[model samples]
Target chain A: MISLAGRDILHAWGKFVFTGVGLGLLIGVTLTMAGVYRGMVDDAKALLDNSGADLWVVQKDTLGPYAESSSIYDDVYRGILGMPGVERAANVTYLTMQVRRGESDVRAMVVGVVPGGPGEPGQPGYLVAGRRITRGHYEAVADIATGFQLGEQIQIRRNLYTVVGLTRRMVSSSGDPMVFIPLKDAQEAQFLKDNDAIVQQRRRTAENPAFNRPGVPGLLNAAIASQSANPYVNAVLVQIEPGYSPDDVAEPIRRWKRLQVYTREQMEKILVGKLIATSARQIGMFLVILAIVSAAIVAFIIYTLTLGKVREIAVLKLIGTRNRTIAFMILQQAVGLGVIGFVVGKISATFWAPIFPKYVLLEPGDAARGFVAVVVICVLASVLAIRAALKVDPAEAIGG
Target chain B: MLTKGIRINGLKKRYGKGETAVDALKGVDMQVAPGEVVGLIGPSGSGKSTLLKCLGAVIEPTAGQMTLGDEVIYDDGWKISDLRALRRDKIGFVFQAPYLIPFLDVTDNIALLPMLAGHPNNESRQRALELLKALDVAHRARAMPSHLSGGEQQRVAIARALINRPPVILADEPTAPLDSERALAVIRILNQMARQYETAVIVVTHDEKIVPTFRRIYHIRDGRTNEEAGEGRAFE
Candidate 1:
């Protein structure tokens, strides 16, 4: 037999298409929300991947240097390098701040790395443009997401640095782009006080009689010099030898060095499980709400359409159309609407994902799941309309 | 009792129970021979609709005997297990408004009945086309019901009713929406279709224009029926 549902849809295709478009937009927003959550998890993984470290050694009893503030002496890497199973160790510091470029400023994670070539643990892996930061001070390598070009001047605290290289996908766990500068410059930017504070400290030292009274002129100056310099870094990144596992190298630091050490897997758990857990929950709640709203819209639309055809349905019944046949027709129409909406939604989400401020990772697996969910929702939503249609008495077609 | 047409004896229907009980059909006895067209005329609330519903097998009779062709369909209770199949294969119905499935074209609307009864699509369509040609609606075979004029839609409805070639047909006010000319034309088509297909046709109508064209008439009132002979006016 000819498909009753198909013919009806063709007869009023304009109505069906317009309604599907409206529902498609809602589905698009839902898909984008899921992509946003995936993007956050991806950003966390990218941060770990670009760090190029087998282990992270930080201050004891802390979750950072990424999830919390961690401070260790800059000389700590020297002691870590001497430990067994350790191949190379580098001092690294991270401070999230707004760096100035001409007039506008962009938020980024300023990273301090020792001036070294590609093999260093904390250095950017590869450069897309220009060269690495070879100078000891006032030189920077930036992630391209920050929109910085090579040779551009960027102001960090009280000094200016020239952007010497650009990289891609180098972002902090919080999704802020990373800018690498020489270790000393990052130390000063993270720890140094203003010039006025420095002058005031020197004046106070000169007035102190215990140091300057007699025979201690050099001693007073030495005290002022030591007070003005910064020697602290955030964390030390360690790479283990080929034969040594991260656990083997990390255990020695934790046991004898009195420091906290995290292996790659442990650090990933900290970033993804603890750092972004709340955000994932929030997105999940939004998904549930959108699903309910979609089901409600489908049910209301199908019910109204069935009600409009009550007379035709009664006549079909009186003329010996099976109850299941009518029910199946309504169900098929609902699923057809869902299929149209899903295609439109998938395209809309793909088209607009890049324009979103944060990374929106739309996975093919997620799309497949979303399509199944939409079909199931449509089938469930069609039940109400089917029940109403089946209840219509065939005798109603006669003039009673 | 005749075996090749429609016959009923002491047909009855009741609603509710006890003092609140209402009888919609009381001892409705009627019959129409093969190839004959008859009219059933009545005022409002006179058991005409209830009798039609009973004849259409849409409702059960409290007490009655009904026979279509050689089969005993109802004797106090339903003798046939599947009334739906009985309605599909042994009876046809034409309604007041020519209520064709609006989404379907003229051909598919008429073809739907035979297709529902397990005929192949092409064969069902062929049968529908033959009936459409016989009813002089072949030109509008591809037109949707909404695109057809009133008379054309009625002719399509007539074709749908005759597609299954059932032994009996129940038409309820089949020409209610037509002008006098179209009303007479519908009655004339019904008579011609009934004789050509050798089917028994019972048209329930209050239309005065076509009442005299019937050779037999059954007037229903107060849940009962009275049989009489009509003027047998010619409509050529």
Candidate 2:
């Protein structure tokens, strides 16, 4: 039998093509929304992966470092390094703030790591350009996403650091690019008050008589020096020995060190399941709304197309056309529209993904699911048109 | 005696119920033989459309016996199990406006009926082409309905009606949209197709120009039919 739907589409292909283009743009936005959610999860994983840590040691009883604020003494990692199954542990601090470059500033996750080589757990794994930081102060390794080049100088808070290296995909859980500075600079940046406030604090400390005894002449100066410096870090990144499991090492640190310890799996859960869970739900709500809107648009378009052919449909029915044939014709047209829209949508999403501010990871698996979903939606959307076509009376063809 | 063409005995149809009931077709009796074309003429309120719908099996009759060939299709109630199949295989229809499917070309429009009845695609198109040639529309076989002239479209419509070779064809105002010459041409094509296919035809029209071409005509007034003689073969 001749395909009634195909012939109709060919006869008015301009209409179908234009409508499909419009619907395809909507599908593209829907796909991009899903990709955004995927990108958030990937960024969180990349943050953990690039840190090169087998475990996270933070302040006791806190989620810390990524999802919450964590403060521990700067000397904590030294104690953790001597434990059995502990290959290496390094002090690390994270502070999300805008870093200035020349005239403009870019949002970045300012990380503080010891002036260690590539093997350190908290240091950036590899640099795409220039050398890793070998200087103890005022040297930085910046993620390429921060738009910093080799030898470029950037200001972290009160001090300026030279961007000595650049790495890729080194971002925080929030998708901000990481700018690696020396541990001491980050401690002062995160904890120390301004110079004016420090001077005022020192003056106040001297006025207190408790530390001003005549027998202890240098005691007040020592107390003032201590008050002017910062001695805290955010967390310690630990790497277990090759023969040992992360849980095996992490448990001892939790008990003996009296600090919160998280294995790799637990940290992943904290980042994905807890940190970005709300964003995932928000994206999910947008997906549901987009799906409903797509379904409704398809239904309206199909229903309108069917009504336009009411006269032909009545004549078909009068000429002994079966209800199923009429219904199938409408269904074929709807699915055809969906197929065209999906092709355009996939192409549109691919072309525009890179230009987005954050990474938009369009996985093949998501495309497959989106195609199936579009087909199912088209089938369901055709129901209203099919019902209307089936209800047409053959007698309408022979009017009184 | 019952004929092998088509005959209706005491056909009746009503609309609504109780006080709002309407007896549109009080009782319609008519006969058209194979190899013959007859006209059904009436005023606006007459039962011509009502009887045409009944004969086409598009609407059920209140009480009647409708026969096609040697089969009693309706006796008070329908005797056929599948009315749709009966309509597809045993009857054909033409409408006032040609009403060809606009999406399809001339050939597929004519061939659609036989295809719907499960005929092979090549065979149906072959039959359709032969009818198109016979109706002098073979040159426009691939043209879509929208591209065809009114007279050409009507000829295609006639080819479509005859494509399935059904025993009976009910044409409602098949030439109403045409001028005098095209109208006569349509009536001539109907007569030729009816005789060539051995199918009976009943045309419902108010066109005075082509009314005299029929050898027999049925004039319906107030749900009753009166047989009259036409000026037969007045085409020349």
Per-residue CA lDDT of model 2 for B60-139, tens digit only, reads 99997899999999999989888888887888898999899999999999999888878898999999999999999999
Residue-level lDDT tens digits of model 2 in A186-283: 98888668778887988888899987777887999998878767788989999999999988998889999999998889999999999999999999
Window of ten residues with lowest summed lDDT in model 1 chain A: A208-217
**Which regions in candidate 2 have their CA more than 4 angstroms from the true location?**
none
Task: Report the lDDT of model 2 for residue B12.
Answer: 91
For model 1, the stretches where C-alpha displacement exceeds 4 angstroms are A196-227
lDDT of each: 0.91, 0.91
True lDDT of residue B185, candidate 1: 90
Per-residue accuracy of model 1 over B1-236 as CA lDDT, tens digit each: 57678999999999899999999888989999998999999999999898999899999999989999999899999999988888888889999999999899999999998888889989999999999899998999999999999999999988898889999999999999999999989999989988889899999998998899999999999989999999877643
True contacts kept of each: 0.66, 0.69
User: What is residue A393's positional error in candidate 2, in angstroms?
Assistant: 1.1
Note the DockQ of each predicted structure: 0.76, 0.78
